[model samples]
Every structure is written in structure tokens, then in C-alpha cells.
Target: MIDPTGRPPAEATGPRRAARPERLEGLVVGLVANPKKNAEQFLDAVGDLLAAEHGIADVVRTRKTSITDPIPPATLDELAQRCDVVLIGVGDCGSCSAAAVADGIAFEAAGVPAAVICTDAFRVSADAMARLQGSPGYAYVTTAHPVAPLDEAGVRERARQALSDVLELLVQAPVPVAAR
Candidate 1:
């Protein structure tokens, strides 16, 4: 399909995909946490689950400055260099949720398997952002809404319930650009 500007389709910009590892076992995982309330707590629980259940060797965690903004290129580059697969999380609102999915796409573009976590309420927003960003059907994990007000036990329980889904998505091999 031709675009309006008479360009055949804007070619995806950036380095070609990095090599995807065969598995997550003993791999270094990157966690890009959005700076919304309890975002780190939510991701930390998920990270714990990844370590305990999936045998993820180590996690390099970074917090984005704000959810409404794009993830810093340096952080992505660093995670790309230091980690194998990544999990970007706590997209409980519209903007942050979209950012998480976009970040996931960026990780995949760089050949790292990634999954974005959000509340069920923001699932549609995350999926829509993925589509708008040229990668429709990007997989993500969702938990209950109102995560910010939740106590530790509440978030932990939500994390536990959602951990399996996050594990499944993070373990998958990166989809080749052609398939996307």
C-alpha cells in the first residue's frame, strides 16, 4: 500500500534487528519501569517471578523519567547491549500504557523479546498504540485496574496472577520484521 506522500511505505528506521537468543534461561533481562506510582513494585514482583519461575539470571532495571515521554534512546541502547529480553511495565493509564507498548516494539526492533504490562483497563490503549506504531497485535500482559491505590499485597497478588502471561510473552523469540 502506498502512503499519501507518494512514498511506498516509510521504511522502518534504525539498525536491523539484533540476534534473538533461543531461550530465556540464564539470560539477562531488562526491566524498563514507567515512573507511575507503584510501577517499580509491580515490576519487581514480576521480576521476582521471572527469576524464581523462569530462571532468569539477572535483571538490569531502569525507570523512565515520565510515562508521557518517549523512552530515552540511551536506555534502550544500554538494555539492548546488556540484556537479552526485556519487560516494560506498569502502563495503567493511557499515555504510559501506550509508551510501554511502543517501548516493546523498540526492543523487538532491536531484537530483544519484550512484553508490556498494564491494567485491564488500558489494554485497548496499548494495543492501539502498537498498531499505530506499525506493529499491530503485539503481545502484552494485563492485570487488574487501579493499581496505584492497591496495597502491597494487592499489587503482589495481581503480579502473581499476571506473571505467567508475562513469562510466556517474554520467552518468545522476536518476530522477524517481515512477519510484522
Candidate 2:
């Protein structure tokens, strides 16, 4: 698939990124939840984990109008200016899964560390989206599939289960240096 930005694949460039902070305390968490069934609920649970455990000072949350559109550049720019790390998701279905990955790519391009969370069933879709976004080997975490049928507790549980991996990626993954 083509990039959402309408750039050709060869011209699809993401910004070179800075390293992740050594610690999470006092950081602001940027969250972009694709308007899938319960994406916001799931992302909020994960954001809460960071805040509760890492002392995150605040959260900036946005819900995209659709599951397929990337978070707008203006929104991403805002998050990049204000947040240390970002999390985007509810990639339970195909198109939304791609959008979630696209959002993470946007964060990475803006010099913010990010995790793109998808469901077990949409793994291929997420990977494909990453590849299309110029991050062929992008790291993503996952919960089980079909969140639309889940209750709040279920979605929260998925968030909790997905937390460790997401935190690991945000805290430990090496930042991609910009192409010189």
C-alpha cells in the first residue's frame, strides 16, 4: 500500500530520531487511538500503566476520526513537541492495524519513541503497514484479536498483557538515526 502522506515509496522519509530517555519518570505520554471498537479504552489502560508505574506526569490523547487515516501531521507535531513517548493502537482489524503502524511511524519520524500495538490476528497487516511506512522491521506488540466483542475489563486485560512489550520497545529499542 502507498503511504498515507501520498509520497512515493522511495521518497517516504521519516525524520531521524533522538534516543529514548533513560527513564520514564516525569514524561508525557502521547496516545493516538484509531477509532476502532474500543481502541481508546485499550490505549488508555496502557497509558495508565506507564503513568502509574513510571510516574508519567501527564497524557495527551487523541482519537482519530477513522481507523485508516494516519494521525494528522499537525497532531503529530503537537505530540512531538510535548511528549517523550507515544503509543497508538487498537489494531484489531486490517485497515486500522495499518493506520496504527502508520501513526507509530509518524511518531518515530517526529523524534518520539513509539509503540504500535496490534492484535494477534492482524500481525501480517501490521507488518505490511510498517514496510509501507519505510520501517520494514518496525517493532510492534500485540494482544488477542477481535476487541470489538470484548468488555472493558477484557480490553484492559489485553492492555496489561501488552504493556511489558510496549514498555520494552519504548524504553530499550534503539532510535533510528536519520539517513545522512
Candidate 3:
């Protein structure tokens, strides 16, 4: 495994994924939004579902300044301090997909579990970005493509479709680097 800077890990075993919360009940969740169309709405829908179904206590939402850059380290630190788990996404295109995945990795390293959402059309780009961030095959959630053109209902449906996957990413057991 590689470091977040794309450097080789100091330990022979390498860096590992952050530990996931065993339960969502009463946990604070963060929603990091990209500036893509409808991204915030989708995140809100997912947040609502999580609150209703899994007893998420509260949600903290923020937006990244750019779609193509990682969330700033300061923001990651703040979110880590405020939230137990984070959801980031609506990565409908290549640049945003890469950014979202990178942010997810950064959040994980900061000791917060993050669920990154991307369109299936850009899954390859998301995976490549994870690898570039020194975390090859890093897991994330994927929905159908072209979210920018989606209506509110369409966006909600996509969120509904992706909710389970997002929860899984946030709470599932960490897959060891060697397992990959």
C-alpha cells in the first residue's frame, strides 16, 4: 500500500484503511458536496435515509471549492473532528470522480470513514484515482450516469439505489491490504 502522498509506506505491511463504525445509531454523519448539479440534493436524500433507517444522529454538510481537487486538509480535519462517518459524491464525470475518491481516502486517513459516490460510467476513473492516491481498489458506491441531467425524482431514485452501498462502505469490515 502507498501513503496518501503516493509514497511507499514506511511499514512493510503498508498503510491500512480506517476502521469502520460498528453501528450507525446516534452517529454524526458528514456530507461533502461537489459543485455538480444535484449533488447536494442526492446527499440530502441519502442523509435522510440514513437518519431514518439507521438512526444517524445528525448531519454536517459542506461543499468543496473545486470539483477536480481534493478536499482541503483543514476541512478534512474539521470533518473528522465533527463526524463519525462521511458521505461524499455525485461524481458523474471524470474529474469529480477522481476528486471524490481522493477526498474519501484523505478522510479515512484522518480517522473518519467516508463513502464516495460516483456514476458507474466513471467507475474506472474513480478506481484509478484511488490507486493514484496510493489506495488501489479502494471501495466506493456507484450509481447510474449523467446525474447532472437528472430530475429531482431521478436523483432521489439514484440515492435510494445507492443508499445500501453507501452504508456498506461506511460500516463494513476493513479489507486488509494484503487481501486485495
Per-residue accuracy of model 3 over 80-132 as CA lDDT, tens digit each: 99999999987988889888988887788888888999999998788777766
Worst 10 residues of 1 by lDDT: 1-10
Give residue 12's error in model 2 in angstroms: 8.8
Expressed as tens digits, the lDDT of each residue in 45-115 for candidate 2 is 98889888888999999888978777888888888999899888888888888788878877887789988
> For model 1, what is the error of residue 133's alpha carbon versus the real structure, in angstroms, after optimal superposition?
0.4
Off by over 4 Å in 3: 1-15, 173-180
Can you list the residue pairs that collide in candidate 3? none
Candidate numbers sorted by lDDT from highest down: 3, 2, 1
lDDT comparison, 1 vs 2, better candidate: 2
Give the TM-score of each candidate: 0.82, 0.87, 0.87
- The per-model lDDT (C-alpha) reads 0.78, 0.81, 0.84
Which residue pairs in model 2 clash with each other? none
lDDT over C-alpha atoms for residue 5 of model 2: 40
Residue 50 displacement (Å), model 2: 1.3
